[model samples]
Target: MKRTTLAIALAVLAWTAWDTGADPIRLGRGIPWLLDFVRRMLPPDLRVLPAALVGALKTVEIALLGTAMAAALALPLGFLSARNVASPAVFHPARVALNFFRSIDTLVYALVFVAAVGLGPFPGVLAVVAYTTTSLAKLYSEAIEGIDRGPVDAITATGATRLQILRYGVLPQVLPLFLSYVLYRLETNIRAATILGFVGAGGIGFYLQTYLRMIDYRAASTVLLVTVVMVMVVDAVSSRLRARLI
Candidate 1:
């Protein structure tokens, strides 16, 4: 077994090296450029407090409203997409639709929404809704698929309809997990919302782009710092809450 494992490892290493054409000396020469880039990001500015705070608040609002809308829509779609509730023939189309939505990133979605809606926070919210629906639907469907079958079987054996089995047997087991996924998606949407502003969808990224264009590194640094702090706080809270749910 040990020899077989070592042989497999060596084969993988050889294949990777050949496929990527990786060279140790070339990588060594690139290290200094990477270090220089890192060194240039030091000593963030603190002077643009007012603008940063306002931008941060806008970002939070966009995330909150977008997430709420996604949760509302996704809850119903999730049920329809789950195999336990819908037969394979019925759920397959829903799965395909969800996958199609999820395949596009939020940035790309923002661009499309901006074109249709003519830009603003509305576009950002729509982008979030689109991406979050895809994500939550996929997650909730998987949760439903993994549920214990005994309760559903028992419910059906009692002459309950498929919808009744889902309502009584499946939803209870998956609600906490679904909620946890929503919170996680909310945290992700907050970060995406910041970038949506770059496309004129409205958020801190709009101000960040403005400062960058004007060569105001100090103001840009303040924006970056505040955004980092907000993301950290959100991630921490979501992590704690998800831990409790799990």
Candidate 2:
């Protein structure tokens, strides 16, 4: 089994090298230019610091709004998708829809929304929502399905309504897991929200692209620095929150 696994890994590596047109000789020749580019980006322009700060705030806002919207919508859809909570007829169709949403990349959703709404943070928010909704729904349904069937069966035997069963039996079991999923997704959306601006979805990424295009390497470097710091801060805070919750 180990030999078979090693053979498959080697075959995959060879296919990747062939498909990507990777050339070690070309990379070796490009090293000097790469070093030169990094050299130019140093001593990042402090003049753009204020603008970068504003862009960072905007990125956080987009992520927060997107995550909130996705969580709100996912709650009902997730319940409907859970086999324990929903019949096959309801859950099967719901699962199909969730799969369809999951198949599309968030950036592609951003492009469509940008074209429809004509740009701004709104499109970025919508894109993240569309992608996160499906992801959270799938996660939440699995959590629901994994709950102790004993409580669910006992609750049902008590002549409890479906809603009551959900409240007393299923929700208590799954809420913590659901909260953890939301926190993790918030961290992910923060990073995703940064790039949505590239397609005019609105964020610091637009400024990054602009500075690079104008050969303003110092300003671009400042933006890159701010982006990195923002992501680090968010990740640290979310990690703490997740630890406490779990």
Top model number, lDDT: 2
Using all chains and alpha carbons, the TM-scores for the candidates as numbered come to 0.82, 0.94
lDDT of 2 by residue, 1-246 (tens): 999999999999999998998999989999999999999999999899999898889899999999988988999999999887889999999999999989998899999999999988889999999999999999999999899999888999999998898999889989999999999999999999889989999888888988999999999999999999999999999999999987
* Clash counts for all predictions: 0, 0
Instruction: Residues 1-246, candidate 1: write the lDDT tens digits.
Output: 999999999999999998998889999999998786446545556667788888888888888898888888887788789886787887999999999989999889999999998867889888888888888888988998889998888888999987798888888889898889899998999889888989998888988998888867767878998899999998999889999997
* Top TM-score hit: 2
> Which residue pairs in candidate 1 collide?
none
Q: Candidate 1 — worst ten consecutive residues by lDDT sum?
A: 36-45
In terms of lDDT, model 1 sits at 0.87
Model 2 spans with C-alpha error above 4 angstroms: 1-12
